[model samples]
Target chain A: MRIPLSITDNIQEWLVSMMSESAASYVAMIIVALIYLGIFAIAGLFLVLIERRVAAWFQLRIGPNRVGFQGLLQTMADALKLVSKELTGTDRADKFLYNLAPYFVIISALMALGVMPFTKEFQAFDINIGIFFLIAISSIGVIGILLGGWASNNKFALIGAMRSGVQTISYELSVGLSLLTMILLTGSLQLSEIVEVQKGGWLIVQGHIPAIIAFMIYMIAGTAETNRAPFDMVEAESELGAGFHTEYSGMKFAYFFLAEFINMFLIAAIAATVFFGAWLSPFGITESIPWLGVFWFLAKTLVLVFLMMWFRWTFPRLRVDQLLTLEWKYLLPINLVNIVIMAFIVWQKLIIQI
Target chain B: MGYFSNIFNGIKTLLTGMSITGKYFLNSRKGAITQQYPDNRETLKMFDRFRGEVIMPHDENNEHACTGCQKCEIACPNGTIEIIWDRGIDEETGKKKKKIDQFVYHLSMCTMCGLCIDVCPTDAIEWGQNFENSVYDRTALTRVLNEPESKVRAGIED
Candidate 1:
């Protein structure tokens, strides 16, 4: 029998025993929110440092070695500098929307983090429809980009925002269908249930051929969704001079920057959970050590994160027309065919079991 | 068939590109092209032929080869060199001879063209490798190449 190591559940029971039910829930909610906020900030900072270091290596340069042991404190120094900078905007810009845009992006990313199964029972909000919740929440971040671009009163920013809207809408279809392909094998929307299903073998192994295809498509679409490079027409630095965030300065810009890295982490986390067996050790090597699940989960997620960074530094940015052509002409059609194939394999019960 | 081939070829090229970068990344410590300037000052050496500035070399007896012929002063395109001369009695020959009282070099006006060094009849001046020429005061750049009370070498011919 498998050991039940539910730390969050234990916390909930302890809180309920100490106080009235409603009061305990209120305190628990606040505590969980604060903890997630801390995770979001720290994860974003470290991802930025990792991205710079990886990029430096790919280009054959020593990146940021002076700041606190291989540039560990570089992002902290950058964040501090950003926090103290003057907040500036165009004189005639839409003040209300301009101020509100960053919150929409950051909050959506934080909400998506809520459902991530870092380990058994470690998730903050174990929603029943976890995959659907993630898809829905991720799409909301594009609205913030659109709003920030439009309210800046700059033509380039507006153009960038519009391109972002178009790109996200097109890529969202592939991301959804790819996940839908995997959902056929697992037959569940809950992330925790999905991980439990992978106890026998990872969805990638059991669902083999089509699962690999879906993963490839998912990675491609996910990179586009995050507005990262090779698909970074949204922030086409050479073309748009920082794109949608051209007018923003200081902490407001930090919110947009941090939200991006957080979104990247979310994409990698989702891929780890759904395809690579979330927190499950390979062949249950550490079955008795339940806490080791967190370690396994993060290790898998960071490998995928490094893969995304590799893509960012390796591939050149796609042109605007080329970007649309890729999603519509290439990715979407392949994605549709891949899902049907997955369905057939599941129906035939041809999956490899451990 | 053509469509499938096109996609396959595209993916192949992308992998090729990734392999090149991946190789570099793995060997980054050995492959980095950047030279940390100030940190590597101890090992930094300028090429021997690098024209930094003109310097007049003196012998152990505080004697130079310059007869104050003013050839460098005439060859200097920017008027960077000036020589002050005096008629002095040559002790060995009992005859009057022209000798430089002051051999002033204005580093600020020099373009490092090496024309003055080339025109020197007695090989009085040669290039110095000290290129740290920055100075706060403009007058500090003007230097006298000859030491005080120094004379031309005994065996030097006019």
Candidate 2:
């Protein structure tokens, strides 16, 4: 197959010309991984600032605008402060797992960033099982929260960890089923193929009610998966004293904090890629400028991210039982019915053709 | 049917909450109540009667109104005010009168209760309305209210 002249392909071509094929591919992989790491670090800081500012607006207060222009350096200053702090853990805590937990969370989040098709040609790895891989890897992040909580040897952290474990497992089903409903319409699990099929129009537009229903379910499940408000039982500070990572301090604590924002960005990016056209401009007006694909993709992802932040600030945290009931009783049944309806629509050729 | 209704009600409530926050967010341009403090100090104005600190009133001629009766000193619950007095000859009356040599106000100790202002027979002390009271040292806070080289106004009875 002739390789498309994308950014990744250019690097691959250069490396292959300079070195052996295997070495080239290996080097390219390392480069892409490093790029994703930087992207997550910057995106984490940006999303936190936006979330805080949006939250301030919701509550009729001005957020941080002092550190730099409009408080842009606030998160940077925060990162520096965290770096300077002494890492502290409980005396009886399991040292090994406590040190390892943040990596579990951060790695899963960064790995998800690699698969996202930023533009038509910019995905690090366009694996055939894109959606499934995303779902699998993203769900593993809760393991870090679980380990962090358990290793702390604190009851609140342990309870928080257990709650997160139950919450993620239950919510994963709804997230998977909802995405499955969309997959039925697209007939492909590969993210680029899904985005390609939506060239007819975004899936939410073409597939009608079932697609919209799937999107809503996906959003709710995604929010829960990220451990955000309304489903933030894992770190319900008022009740659990920051829940799972209660004993974590300094840079260790910052890793968990940064991972939460990075995970939020991943969830938003995935939703934008799969449901909305990943890099497609509205009405295909900007289709000629393929490089503008990155801009379009970021715009769509940020809008979704803002929507999630809105949900976070507006809604209160759910009780643990209520959270479980939300997934099993409300979201799960709706997802099942929605998938069936999507199947019927596809079988009958009721999907809108461009 | 009841199950569906319950779900609908739950969503409706959630939407209602979102709308309230959305209204505030959208109207933030007009509704933001932040003063931006130091930046707005030039335009910011305190209420006319807001009691911020104690000050002895002086006229343009550098003559003060204090007779040093010590009523304010007596009325202050916190002992935040001290009146130093000495008998002096009134220029107009040619009579010996009690006049304030110094009116010492320890702003650090002042509770801003306005009792001294209320009990002043000569209406010498009143609220300054200057609330920026932070100082580098405690001694800086202890202010002498009377301007240097000023005396009690003539024709004012002791």
Candidate 2 local distance difference test against the native: 0.89
What local lDDT score does residue B60 receive in model 2, on the 0 to 100 scale?
96
Per-prediction TM-score: 0.82, 0.82
- The regions of model 1 sitting more than 4 angstroms off are A1-7, B45-133, B138-158
TM-score of chain A of each: 0.97, 0.97
Q: What is every candidate's C-alpha DockQ against the true complex, given to 2 decimals?
A: 0.60, 0.58
Q: Write model 2 residue lDDT over A1-354, tens digit each, in one string.
A: 332324568788899899988788778788877887887798798888999999999989898999999999999999999999999889888999999999999888888877788887788778889999999999999889989999999999999999999999999999899999999988899888998999999988889999898999999999999999989999998999989989989988989999999989888898998889989998999998999999999999999999999999999889988998888889998889888999999999999877
Could you give candidate 1's per-residue lDDT for residues A289-321 as a string of tens digits? 988988999999999999998899999999988
Off by over 4 Å in 2: A1-6, B46-130, B135-158
In model 2, how large is the Cα lDDT of residue A28? 77
Clashing pairs in 1: none
Q: Extract clashing residue pairs from model 2.
A: none
